[model samples]
Target: MFLGIDIGTSSVKAVVVDGTQRLIAAASTPLAVSRPHELWSEQHPDDWWAAVEGTVAELRAAAGRSWAAIGAVGLSGQMHGAVLIDGAGRPLRPAILHNDGRAFGEAEELNRRLPAIGQIAGVPAMPGFAAPKLLWLAHHEPEVLRQARHLLLPKDYVRLRMSGSLATDMSDASGALLLDCARRQWSPEIAAACGIDLSLLPPVLEGSAVAGELTAPVAAAWGLKPGTILATGAGDAAAGAIAAGAVNEGDAFISLGTAAQYFVARESYRPAPEHLVHSFCHGLPQRWFQMAALLNGAGALAWAAELLGKSDIGAMLAAAETAFTGPSPLMFLPYLTGERTPHNNAHARGVLFGLTPASGAEQVTQAVVEGVALALADCQAYVAETGALPEQIAVNGGGARSPFWMKILASALGKTLHVQEESGAGPAFGAARLARLALTGEDPAKVCTKPRIAAEIRPDPALADAYGGKLVQFRNLYRAVKPFYQ
Candidate 1:
């Protein structure tokens, strides 16, 4: 048995899988993000540790005797979070998350100072990247910077507690804006430019390599044997791609979780900074992928459901589906936490336009779903420009379970979407497979086969035509409101 853990924006999930790649058991613990200040998102590292422990305990309880058979562990987590640690491995403060937009000024300053930053890092210097968060701390919270001795991404910090080692995998490190991504290592020059010492960063390792053995205390606490291998895992999106069998050229998947991502695997590196598309190393060796990310995804749907006074999102979606005969006059911009793809604007905020007295819960809810679909359509346009379009895209995440949203997305993008039997189990399953590779020395291609398809969603000609018109209006609305946000 292998163990896989994912530290996500709103929860911590763990899964147990056998050698045949079948899931044995799984558990998740809920988490909350604190927005103490406007445009800021933070989570306490201690809360993450507690959630990880709690979820692992739940998994152990479910696995029973099979728990002791676990031989290796793997981790996957939200990317680009900044976790500052003191000399003794204590958190200096709450970790700033990827959706936080407080560092917009710092991102611009870095881009102004380092002209080749996008080329070096394989991504634009955006506020969500870790380097800008560090710079923001240096300027506004100097005391925290003064005492900080190390920086780790969300999963690496968890790994540190498990194995008493400070290290990160190349896939997670790529999002930090401190890595020479093409070379798969930290760039001393970029670190120096950010006024950060290279020593503050953890050592980078391959995603499938052994990071360390579990410490005896943690092993005993989790009811695992001592000296179990801990594989260097990946960021959540890359792991999801692995689980979807998107490891080859032109293979792609769209994720609709806390954040939305359109990922396409590539055989070689192809940087498209001008389009704000992310080029990063893949979880496996000698591979890469291009990603277009939006900060708001299923989270926007949740917000709309609460605002409409519905306790259940599924019911809200059903209402929206019943009301979806044609496009509504109401339109929404799903930029609740700013945006990443195509436009690198961090000051942008959500907007609801064309509201009338006739507008009600169903119209507003459908608008929210359509709005997200339009934003992803914009992202898909840019990804298509890179000539990495897939024959069919795998769709997964919390939102993927909604038939209404999947139909909307398929029509908006005009492509077929494969819904797997294990639709939302991508990241945890991928991490477990990576653990299996590390423990058994098996080929990744053989280990990460695509799951069986439960169903396929295709575009409706009429709905696609309607969305095509709505797409133009959506772009115009953003252009009209861009200056107000600035």
Candidate 2:
């Protein structure tokens, strides 16, 4: 048996995969992020490890006796969250999450030094990336920065607790903004500008390489045999790509969890300078991906539910299903939290520009769905700049649960949404598949996605024409709101 784990912002999920990549058992436990105020999001590093122990205990209780000796393990987690450790391995303070945009002011200053950053990382500057988060810590929480000896991404901290070793995967490291991701090495220039020595970062390992072995303490606590290999895994989304079999050039996938990003796999490193899509190294060797995050998907729905409807999420979807949208001019700007791709603005807020008192919850719900689609379309436009339209787009994350939203997305982007073969298992499944890959040395490229032909929502020509006009208006709304935000 091989084990795979994914540490998310709000949860830790574990899965056990047999040699054939068949999932034997899976479990998840939630972890809380303490955001004391607006412009802050933080989590204790210990909170993640506690959940790992809890989940591993559940895994052992369920599958410990029957399985053969564990051969390997792989790990994936949410990216860009900063975890600081002292020389004795004690954490200094809470981790600053990728979603925390307090560094927007810091990002502007960093952008002025963009020529050097672009040459190294092949991507534009963003506050959500790790380096800025660290810079913010240095400025605001210098006591923590002063006491810190090593810094790791959230998942790496979990891995340290599991195997007593320090490591990070290239895919996750790429998001740190401290790496020359294109060259698969640390960028000396970025480190200098941020006043950070590259030594503060963990060693980069490829997706399938052995990161470390489970130590005696972890082995006994988790009831695992000693010396089990732990394979260096990837970021949650990259691991999800491997699990969904979206691993090669031109293959595309989308995840609509707390946040949404359109992931497109590519063979070489390339940044879209014109469209502002994010470029990063992929989990597979010699592979890369371009991602455009919408910043709101399920989050927008949750807010709408809290404000307009009750707290029931299913009710929002059900209401959206009956609601009228095709004939209306109501527009939803999904920038409830600022946007990353295309606009890259942090101050932008959500706007309901065409709302009338006559509008009901369904129309509001439809606008939320359409707003997500338009943001997705912006990503499609970015990839079009590379002269390739995604042939089959695979859907994952919470948005995949809503058929109504899927229909709008399909019609909006004019692409068939191929639902994955399994229920969305998130990135834990990715870790399991990669763990299986390491043990058997199987070729990942051959494990292509055979997604089921779920009910296809063909593009409504009339609705498409209407949305085309509305998209222009949608873009205009953001522009009109730009001054207020600035």
Candidate 3:
């Protein structure tokens, strides 16, 4: 059996897989994130450690006979969160998460320090990325920076606890903004510019390489053999890509999480200035990926539900099932949490317009859900602008569980939506598969499949025509609201 662990913003998930890459058993536990100050999302490294141990034990219980045979481990986690550690590897402070915006000002300073930052990163210097978060600590929390000997991201932290190694995978390192993504190595120039010592960073390893092994202490405590191989895992999204079964080019998945991104695997790294989609190295060498992010999806839907909804989720979906928008002059901009990809605006916010007293909850709810879907369509259009249209899209997440969201997204994209029938699994299992590949040099293409469609929703010409018009309105909202963001 092989083990894969995913450390996410909300939880840590662990999965045990056999040599065939078949998932044997999986387990997860919540890892609460704390925001002590505005715009700063943090989680205790101890909490993550507890989660890793707990989830692994749960996986052992679930995996049964295979537990004693496990030979490898890997991890996937939330990208860009900074985990600072002392000499003996104790966490210096709570981890700074990917969603934290407390470093926006430092991001600007870091931006001016690099000449071709945009060209190098394929995305603008944003406060959410790791380098900016590190700078935030340097400027304000110098004590933490001074005492901290090494920095690791979410998954790497878990890897360190398991392997007694300081390492990271290329997929997760790409989010640090310190990597020369095309070359798949750290940039010394960026290190100098950011004023962070290069040694403080972990070495970049490939996603599938054997990272380290479980030491005796961790082994005994977790009921595993010592020296079990640990593979440098991937980021949650990349792992999700594997889990979603998009192992080759032309296949991709749209994730509607606290944030959202559209990803397609590629054979090479080719930057697109027009679409501004992120061009980064893939988990597989000689391959690359392009992703467009929406910054908000389920997050927006959840916010709408909280404000305009009272009933349970099923009842709410039932109440808001019907749609009427383009012809009605109602529109929504689902930017409640800023945006990435095409537009790198951090000051943006979501809006709902064209409300009437008669404009009941259905209209607003449909507008929000459809607006988010259309915004995703906007990402596909960006890909279309770049000349690569995915023949199929795999939709997954909290949003994918909603049939209403799936049907609307299918209609808006004019593509078939393939759903995975797996029970409550996402990026973590994906991380395990990638780790399996990383360790055994296996081809993930052979193992994964988009689950049989529990049901397929064909696009109605009428709905498509209406959404086409609203999509135009949707794109313009960002441009029109530029001054507001500035």
Q: Put down candidate 1 lDDT per residue, 1-486, tens digits, no spaces.
A: 999998999899889998877788999999999999988999999999999999998999998888999999999999999999999999999999999999999999899888788888888799999999989999999999999989999998999999998888888999888988889899987898799889999989888999998999999999889999999999998988888888998899998888999999998888888889999999999899899989999999988988989999999989888877888789999999899897888888899999889999999999999999999998999999877596589988888999889999999999999987676776877788889888998888898888888779999899999999999999999999999997
Judged by whole-model lDDT over C-alpha atoms, candidate 1 comes out at: 0.90
Judge candidate 2 at residue 101 and give its lDDT: 74
Lowest lDDT block of 10, candidate 3:
321-330
Per-residue lDDT of 257-337 in model 3, one digit per residue for the tens? 667778887776666745667766666566667788667777777677779845465567677775544334568888765
lDDT by residue (1-486, candidate 2, tens digit) is 878898987678888877655667878888886869766778899999899989888887777664446778889888888889998877888888877778887776776765667556756777778888777787888888788889899889988887888988888888887878778988888887787888888899888777888898888777777887888889987887877677778888888777787888888888775577777888777888877766676778877887884777787778778765473567888887677787877777788767788888888878888888887886678767764757578887667878888878877787778766453565777887667666667777654343454455566777777777777787888888899985
Error of 3 at 79 (Å): 1.1
Candidate No. with top lDDT: 1
- Misplaced by over 4 Å in model 2 are 58-70, 324-329, 447-457
Give the candidate order by descending TM-score: 1, 2, 3
Assess candidate 2 and give its lDDT: 0.78
Q: After superposition, how far is residue 436 of candidate 2 from its true place, in Å?
A: 1.8
Clashing pairs in 2: none
With a 3 Å backbone cut-off (N, CA, C), the pairs that clash in candidate 1 are none
lDDT (C-alpha) at residue 325 in model 1: 80
